[model samples]
Target: MSKQVVFTIKLEPELRDTFMAEAAADDQPAAQVMRELMRGYIEQRRQAREYDAYLRRKVEVARADKTAGRGFSNEDIEAEFSAARDELGQVV
Candidate 1:
């Protein structure tokens, strides 16, 4: 088991009632619902940041490839794939 910390947040009465009702409809305690929501929010934000970093790395690689004159044109890619398909006796 991990150590847990006590945290609290203030919500408007109406909003809190609504949240509790939704949690009850789902057969979950309101605290559990809030925990799940918090975890999902954190996961989504983390994934967004990771995706942004991945895009940055991909752009850097593309720029380096361009600088080194190592990239292919659309025609070049199509031709290469066509040749590979022919070699493998596969239909396009």
Candidate 2:
């Protein structure tokens, strides 16, 4: 395991009491609970950033496709789906 550093923060008494109580109820230490919460929050933010980048790339590609006349219209999509439905003996 890597060497750990000490960190400290202040919290309101009420909030601290509630957090401690909840941690005790789960049979875990408050520090462990805080660590898990921090890890989860960091992961969620990381995923959100990755998703944003993916969306930006998709939008850029879509814009490039539109400029190159490679984009399809809604009517084209509907027509393609209609044709597929007919071939598969399904109702539109």
Candidate 3:
């Protein structure tokens, strides 16, 4: 393992007791469970950042398209939806 860093976490008595009981039931220390949870949390955060960047790029590309300036009127949007629904046999 890498160098160790000690840190303190303050938990209410009731929560602390519950955590210890669950940890013992699983036959693993709470610290190990916390590490696993931290790993998953970090992964999700990284994914969210990547998706945000992708969405920003997609929006920039969409704005540069001439068709986007046509900015569908309500009637245009409804007509397109009606055509799609008719093709798909959907209840419009």
Candidate 4:
């Protein structure tokens, strides 16, 4: 990976010192840790967006099915299950 750009942020002096000390203790560069954290955050956001799109598509399809009368109603579902249970001698 090529990191040709420098990103700068301002933090409290104590926070910077503590972060540097922790990075030193872990034997890892602070920049590398920050890069990994940034990548993880990006991936999390991407997955959330994909999931949101999937749910929206599902809702749209359900709505279309309802408009076309192509899906079962709640009462229809309950009646079908009740009949199946009766056939199997199971309590409702």
Candidate 5:
């Protein structure tokens, strides 16, 4: 099932003509071009927003660890890696 909704937009004559011209150039309908533009814009915004949030979270965690002096030694990390690799047969 599909729902039908109506939206109204105000655009200048030049932009409208430009949209139509571009649509013709692509051999696609103006509505299709508009839909593609909207979907791409929305998807890009979502990805950017999520990545921004992830970076912010990582920075906050790193800052907290820095203030608390919470860290692992290189030898400790290497030992853990070696054990996991030896057990899992995934690395040397």
Candidate 6:
């Protein structure tokens, strides 16, 4: 098992009391609730970092495609989609 340590923070008395009351209402220890909250916050930050990296990679790929003349123009895309829609309409 991993060793545990005490984590301390200072907050307003009213806020602390309210948090403790909510945890008690749920039949959970205040410390356990705090730990869960901390874990959730960490996961949220990790996901944000991952999404930011993914976005950066996508932007880089798009920029590289544009640089290599492999990117399409807005008009080209619109025309292609319009032609597809017309074809579908004909089929229906």
Instruction: Provide the overall lDDT of each model, using Cα atoms, as 2-decimal numbers.
Output: 0.90, 0.92, 0.85, 0.95, 0.87, 0.95
Writing each residue's lDDT as its tens digit, candidate 1 over 45-83 gives: 999999999999999999999899999989999999999
RMSD of 3: 3.8
**Top model number, TM-score:** 6
State the weakest 10-residue window (summed lDDT) of model 1: 1-10
Writing each residue's lDDT as its tens digit, candidate 2 over 1-92 gives 36398778888999999999999999999888888898999999999999999999999999999999999999999999998989888642
- Tell me which of candidates 1 and 5 scores higher on lDDT: 1
Give residue 4's lDDT in candidate 4 (0 to 100).
98
How far is each candidate from the true structure, as Cα RMSD in Å? Answer: 4.0, 2.8, 3.8, 2.5, 6.4, 1.4
Per-model TM values vs. the true structure: 0.67, 0.77, 0.69, 0.81, 0.69, 0.90
Error of 1 at 32 (Å): 0.6
Best by lDDT: 6
Give me candidate 5's TM-score against the actual structure. Answer: 0.69
Ranking by lDDT: 6, 4, 2, 1, 5, 3
Which residue segments of model 4 deviate by more than 4 Å? 89-92
Per-residue CA lDDT of candidate 4, range 21-54, in tens? 9988999999998898899999999999999999
Superposed Cα RMSD, model 6: 1.4
Compute the lDDT of residue 3 as modeled in candidate 6. 33
Candidate 1 Cα errors over 4 Å, as ranges: 1-3, 72-92
Error of 3 at 16 (Å): 1.7
lDDT of 1 at 80: 97
Pull out the clashing pairs in model 4: none
Q: What is the lDDT of residue 45 in candidate 1?
A: 100
lDDT of 6 by residue, 20-89 (tens): 9999999999988888898999999999999999999999999999999999999999999999999999
